[model samples]
Target: MHGTIERLDDSALASARDRAWSIPLDEFDPGDPELFRTDSFWPYFDRLRKEAPVHYCRDSVFGPYWSVTRYNDIMDIETNHAVFSSAASLGGITIRDTPPDFRRESFIAMDQPRHSAQRKTVAPMFTPTHLDQLAINIRKRSAECLDNLPKGEVFDWVDKVSIELTTQMLAVLFDFPWEDRRKLTRWSDIATTLPGPDGLVATEDARQAELMECAAYFKRLWDERINEAPKSDLLSMMAHAEATRDMDPRNFLGNLVLLIVGGNDTTRNTLSGSIYALSRHPDQCRKLLENPGLIDSFVPEVIRWQTPLAHMRRTALEDIEFRGRQIRKGDKVVMWYVSGNRDDEVIDHPYDFIIDRARPRTHLSFGFGIHRCVGIRLAELQLKIIWEEILKRFDNIEVAGEPKRVYSSFVKGYETLPVRIAG
Candidate 1:
């Protein structure tokens, strides 16, 4: 039964590859969310990297934008802050542009001195000493969560494990109410979801309403935190810090959404992805079983393979020519980190998931330059600790069905994943 399923999946992917080649280069909209939802977007990016490393789409749902597909080209674009801007006033970091009135400024979407100042407010949370402190709680929660799973029955790994653990971690970081922690998950999903009948919300206005609710909830927390002496939690850090204390309403919400989504999605999806990856590559699973020490290498390889957040966007500050392609000022330039992770030139056998790869951390999953993910060490620690606990408890956890992926090109994640653990 599993072999038949594998064959069918292979045939579908082969068809996708054929279609990707048959379509003209100019007609390709690699940023299409449907492609990511179906996991058929690989071939589109493969073709773009080969033929048009710096290609421009004449039109897309997110409007016309430039794609930098190759690994080195993306690094160049990521580092060139003078030419490429990440300001919220200029559409921010995603391919989709927020309306001018709706735009909010967060540290990741800000450039220069201000970005550093705001980001520094929460920097202490992810330091080595702090992570050592966080590790004990992470392991305790992970062990408890794993021990509670039903054996000899199928369950959604995404909900029962991934979301539960990551949301718990987010609650700890924010010192958020334990009973209301799931609200962080809802707000994280709402912040990134495309509005439609199929999405989290039915319309843009509906989406905004929920986000405003998130803002109000956090504002209450912020009010409470400000009244007290300085604390180590993220909310208290920002409330007491000079850089973030006096932020405007939009900026406050923007930073809130940024921290929420950053804390929630990346770790959540990658936890789910690690299970799915190992289930498909049982040989690597066996190797991991033999040498549990490989958990260190396995953590990063899965992160690179998953490339949790697919792409980051920058607005061209001034007209500039890059790699023989002319880019105009104010153009939305998307650096496809998803493709860069799979670039054959930089990574050996980029398509394969080798758990013990020597240079496992070479991929662009966490991005590059100053704008790289701030919670990177904490993310790795969570994955490593979970897998260590898993190896201690279970011999194997089987993937029972195909994963239902998120319908967003930006947030590469699983909505659900069916799995079973043998009794």
Candidate 2:
């Protein structure tokens, strides 16, 4: 039965690869959420990296955009903030544009002086000293969470482990209410989800309504934090910081959504991805199990392998020529970090899931330049500590079934992954 399922999956992928090649270059909509959900977007990116590298799609559901596919090219665009803008007014950092009325200005969505100011408010949280303090709490929670897992039975690793731990961490970071912590997960999902009958919310209006609720809830917290003596929590830091304390309503909500999604999704998805990656590459799993010291390297390799949050979009500031291609002012440019992570020219044997790569951190999973993920160190710490605990407990954790992936092209993540561990 397992072999038949594997063969069927292979056949479907082969067929998808054929379609990817047969389609006209201009018709390629690699950013389509459907492709990511089905896990059939690999061939499209592969073809683009080889044939186009810097291709433009004249029409997509998200409209016309440029895709930068190679690793070096993505770095070039990521670093050139003067030419490429991440402004919320310019459609923000995703291929899908937020309507002008709906636009929210987060630090990642803002460029330069303002961006640096807002981002610095939360910088103290991820410092070495802070992470050392966080590590003790992380390990305790990870052990408890793993200990409670149902052994000798199938369970969704995504829900039981990934979402649970990351949500807990977010709650700690914000000093949020314990019972209401899952609201962070819900808001994070709602922030990135595309509005449809099948998505988290059925319409853009519904999505915005939920987001407004999130804003209201956080506003209450902001009110509390602003009055208190300043502390280490993210809310208090922002409430006390000069740059963020007096932010406008939309900017406050935008930064709230940014921090929630940033602190929740990337680490959560990568946690699930690590299990799936190891399940597929048992040899690497064995290496880690035998010599647990490899956790340092293993954490990063899995991050690179997953490349959670597949791409980041930047709007061209002005008409500029890049790598022989003419980019016009106000163009929406997407740097395909997913494709760049697998670019053979930059990473040796990019397709493999080797845990001990000498340069595991070479990939662009957290992105590059000034707009890189602020909580990156904290993310690595969570993954490392969880695995350290996981290795100490289970001899084998079997992937009982295939993973159900997220529908959004932006958040590369597992919705569910059935797994079993021996009793």
Candidate 3:
């Protein structure tokens, strides 16, 4: 039995390798949105899960890194703060060339005492009550933004609904000038993301130039907001941190850049992604429309389906064995949330789009441990309220064209989703 099983296993492995090689890596460009729309990723990710849960890939532009593809393993490494630290020296979340000070500026890069302190100062702002308050404003803004939807005429949902609504809400959170909120969104996009496939921002020099421009824009926003008295907004809270909390210029700007990026991009993609999923499954859409109450639970389903922030990289402080693999000290490990969401161990029917999928929060979209998304509740709130408002006004919403995703591996999102208001 053992010999027979060994032969069977060898055969299965051979078959998978043969299939994997059929699609060349050159065919998939990490920075191109077109790649996301292809079948290449789902199969590749599935293969990673089956073959190497903890595997290494050297093909990426950012260089070689280990991919952590299991649900339990990803969580173990994520919450195991002692073994896996978020230090800038170990490399920040994204696998990229970050300026020395750049990694030090954000909480995502901090570990231990510093992470706790910075996160605590910012946590109260996203409390249940605070988010509840923000929900009303977000709903109003979403309504107004969606109100302009011309019947039957197709338009890009990413620009009009997803990106626009989130940007506007971030502006409100920071209490920044309404007219320039889009600037914040643009800066956040630039601060993250490698160059696009058409060789745009391909070199570090170009990326650095963009980062400087991003920092300069935020600095102006900070100079203007820093003087204002503390208000209920996030900026006011962050401003007060200087005296009552622990933060400096570098960290402040870093966190500020992070907040705008986090609050803007992930939600934007998921929102656009939700529409894309519904467009594919009109049955699911009708179920949602028929049982509007499903929206409450469906929001999590939307997030799980999208898995916006595809994967985050964690640097091992020291050598540690994980999921049958020896991860060396200072090795870059990627926690592929997209793969984890489909983990058969934790999630049932991993491939199905079950809107009423109970315990949808069990998904790793927000990640696990202390470093989980600080704006998680806020993100869900935005999606829920936006959909709630959308369902209230429009009877039928459909995707009118192919949805374009972003070129960055860090933020897996749609660039354009032409949608129509159903009659």
Candidate 4:
């Protein structure tokens, strides 16, 4: 029975892929985990944009969904919040279907009134004045990290730099204990992990246990903050905010997970991706080395090129006709930002990682509409400062081995990227 079940599962997956391939490009399913893991999703997306800007996958590991592949179509869908909902109850913003019993509600997963209220509470953190204050510390940290790198010794850039720097930034944002900062990365990984050897949890049961521990730790912080005076840190801000203060235990844990993952993955992945991209395109790196003034333009281009979060899911709130496609109420609709960034109609030389593009911020990596990445400025700032520090310290940061990519369709990121610096 066990062997039969295993073979049946394999056959079903093979059948699914075969069907996906055999169908018209417009009907192709882009949700396969293997495509993203192998970094071969570009051609599939290229075909989707050229053939079917608005596509649909009748079935996937997640479920039936519509994919808006073109740049304009994605912006249209993202901006039309009235037609499409991001409510947690409907299925929060990822292709992964939120289980009925395991509902985790956060501001990013909410729509309209509540999302506005909750988001307003945290918006101040990214303000120009606030970010300016944060910049000093970010540069200091970036310099220290780069200075400490082992010269000429190959190391996992993902661990040594990407994870370390982002994790440190997260710890400061939450005013979390510096010693326990790495826990933030672990929880972030667990929250987004798929069930497998690469996943943090082996089963749903294990995931729940780890998440509970995450909640318990944060609950203690919540307890401490609630009793104290309102402060500038995220924990205090959320604890005092009218919209989020009275949140249920699950919602509190949900929002905490949301913030951690938001703050961790996007920036970390881009930092790793930037190095890998630059290594592959030496001319671009050389151009940047010649002109450090291009860091502002270079950072956004990397965000576009890397597209850390590949897709964002939305549930249709009402029946609507989008580009001749019939989308019914409660149906899943995904905005494939990864595909849109590469849309040649919008971006010139979309495949190449050019640092000095005339319009660098035109991409949808940070997304469109009110639900755009709240920490986008901070993400950009960190990347810019880190690269500035990197160039000051090293002549060339060479890729030492093939990168080990994360096994997920959602978080387009690296697990390990080996590197050695030349001065």
Candidate 5:
């Protein structure tokens, strides 16, 4: 029965590999967005990890970049920020290069003193004390969403549960208007989407227009909050904070994109992934059902199992030789977190969703170094609460159909996941 399920689960992947081998081994382009959309990029990374851990692609749609496939190699690059810069001036943090005119600066894409100063502005919001206070509300909302799931009826979990929960939390954090909260989701999509026929935007021009609208709307909020006294919400925090208070239009917009995407995508996709993965591994799901105490371990394992963001790009600051490969200055280096999480050398049974792994937290999903996800605690809290509430409410969330994955290589998220609960 397990073998049957496994074969059925990997049918799409089996077909994708057939086409994936058409490209020459040396010229393999792992950044092809279509490979991700079809859920067929696994084999490509597997080959890279074995053949060329520090492989370079001379050409891709996003131009030239190096793929760091192994676990240690990625950490080596991620930790040395002095050598691998995340600045927007040096092409930002995605395989896609930032256009000269459209270049925007956010702390995630900045280095040193400026990055430290800007990061400090929002650091207090994710502290243990603040998260503890937020936990009460998180549990309340999670319960409400899970309890309200329609019994014996199919629904898109990505929209109703995953997107709904993450959207609500973001709204509360930013004190954004409740009715207009979905705009956050739209802007998050726009900010990350590759402009193309197959992707989010039809043209670069339309992408910029939507971004301008996002900037103008936030500018209004900034204008209002700058006059008022300090408050705890993210908008007010930025408005009153010294470093972010006087941000230019582009800088303000860039930070908003970072916050929205960070706050929404990672936790949201993982929520959907938990249900999907559990459905695939009935043994683990049964174990979880029998022992609700496993929620603590289960959450982090799911984050690693579903590596929400596949990779983050960093530009080499100077000419250097890494792993005997000549890496020149101004070169783009991408850390494949998805591949690293599945590296068998570092993780035991790395591909399996082991809910009770001994060291569940040992993965590259949150990344390494100073630029590690600022909202890691908040994300874990949201996932833990949702699953805790889920166990109290339902025995199973059946995967009604194959999930539709997002087309972009950067976001590495679900477009929809159909699920149904028992009556």
Candidate 6:
């Protein structure tokens, strides 16, 4: 039965790719308000899934490429990491143009034995067993953040709570001075902001400048810690690993920047979007409020509705036939998780945000295979706790003004969510 299902999926994707795809190659405007209506991208993805799951277009500003959107089709490419790889030294994990400084930097851009080695050093700490130790603290912090929210007043949820809370946790992880944690957050914002969308903004320079400054600051902190022993934070762990077992400083910076995103933006977006989702769906909100036990399921549903990291790009390491479309060895292929998470075949209903939805956690906002997000559990825990606390503290919470979305196709999330909360 499973084998037949798999074959049918493959055949459907192949047929789709052979058909003329609907996505225009001309300059893509992600900012179009029409896009916001389809931001979850259901209609377009459904069309693309039927028309061309791995179809190509010639006019994309980052140059021509195929969009790999269906769940199984994306799974085939992502799971076969050796063929469609992130280790491409040129463009790195993304197909967009790479910064000159990053052409040969970071473990994320490294392949094979080296990638395994660097990934191993930090992977142990992120395991569920280790994360279990930190859950209590995360819950405590989340409660404190929510418990202190200004009652009956409107505030930007993204700025006032989500970003602030996540950055504080990141500071705890990095063992940095919590007071200046916003610097790390700013560097991450800039890092991911670069090669902006279609690689059009020329903001990569500014992003690199901020990253270098942050890296230098980290190096200085490492020196200071060496002069006077520091605590057991992620930075200290990386520093020790670097000194005892060879590790590149640039890789540390790259991963540190990556960690910030893993730890901050996704969680922030989830929290911010959770508030918006709750405000919009009063029934689900009431359900969560009435039966907080469902908060666990609600976390995953929020991710499904507000998928934090919308998409991740990969470059073909070798000529490959993805759903019948020939992806040349140097070709760029994007995995639209934004589309895949909403894939009708993989998900039931695909549109409803049921708080008690059976297994709402099945979606993959986190990448699959070798590069799957290590902090997935932590992010989930943070969201669940925040929801629990909000439900307890505020009887009613709502959007008081227009919500603004972050202007990035890759990390499509909320930038401002105004709300009035009452006890």
Model 3 TM-score is 0.88
- Segments in model 2 whose C-alpha atoms lie over 4 Å from true places: 1-8
Off by over 4 Å in 1: 1-8
323 in model 1: Cα distance from truth in Å?
0.1
Residue-pair clashes, model 4: 0
lDDT of 6 at 308: 85
lDDT of 6 by residue, 1-423 (tens): 000011124565455434324446243322232343324344556667766666675665456667777878777777877887676464766536565566534555566667666666666567777687777778888888877788777788788888888988888787788789999778767766634454324566766777788888888887776566644566666666643234566666767777777888888888887777776667777787778899888888988788887677777888877666678887877777877887888888776778888778778788777677877887887777677677677766767765666656667667677777764
lDDT per model vs. reference: 0.94, 0.93, 0.74, 0.87, 0.88, 0.69
Consecutive 10-residue window with the lowest summed lDDT within model 6: 1-10
The parts of candidate 6 lying over 4 Å away from their true place are 1-42, 194-202, 226-231, 242-245
Candidates sorted by TM-score, descending order? 1, 2, 5, 4, 3, 6
Q: Residue 304 of model 3: what lDDT?
A: 93
- Pairs with steric clashes in candidate 3: 31-407
**Candidate 4 TM-score to native:** 0.93
Can you rank all candidates by lDDT, best first? 1, 2, 5, 4, 3, 6
- Residue 143, candidate 1: Cα error in Å is 0.7
- Residue clash pairs of candidate 4: none
> Clash number for every model?
0, 0, 1, 0, 0, 0
lDDT of 2 by residue, 1-423 (tens): 011113127688889999999999989999999899988898999999999999999999999999999999999999999999999999999999999999999999999989999999999999999999999999999999999999889999999999999999999999999999999999999999999988989999999999999999999999998999999999999999999999999999999999999999999999998888887777788888889999999999999999999999999989999888899999999999999999999999998989999999999999999998989899999999999899888878888888898999899998998888988
True lDDT of residue 350, candidate 1: 96
Error of 2 at 23 (Å): 1.7
Q: In angstroms, how far off is 78's CA in candidate 4?
A: 0.4
Q: Give per-model TM-scores.
A: 0.98, 0.98, 0.88, 0.93, 0.96, 0.86
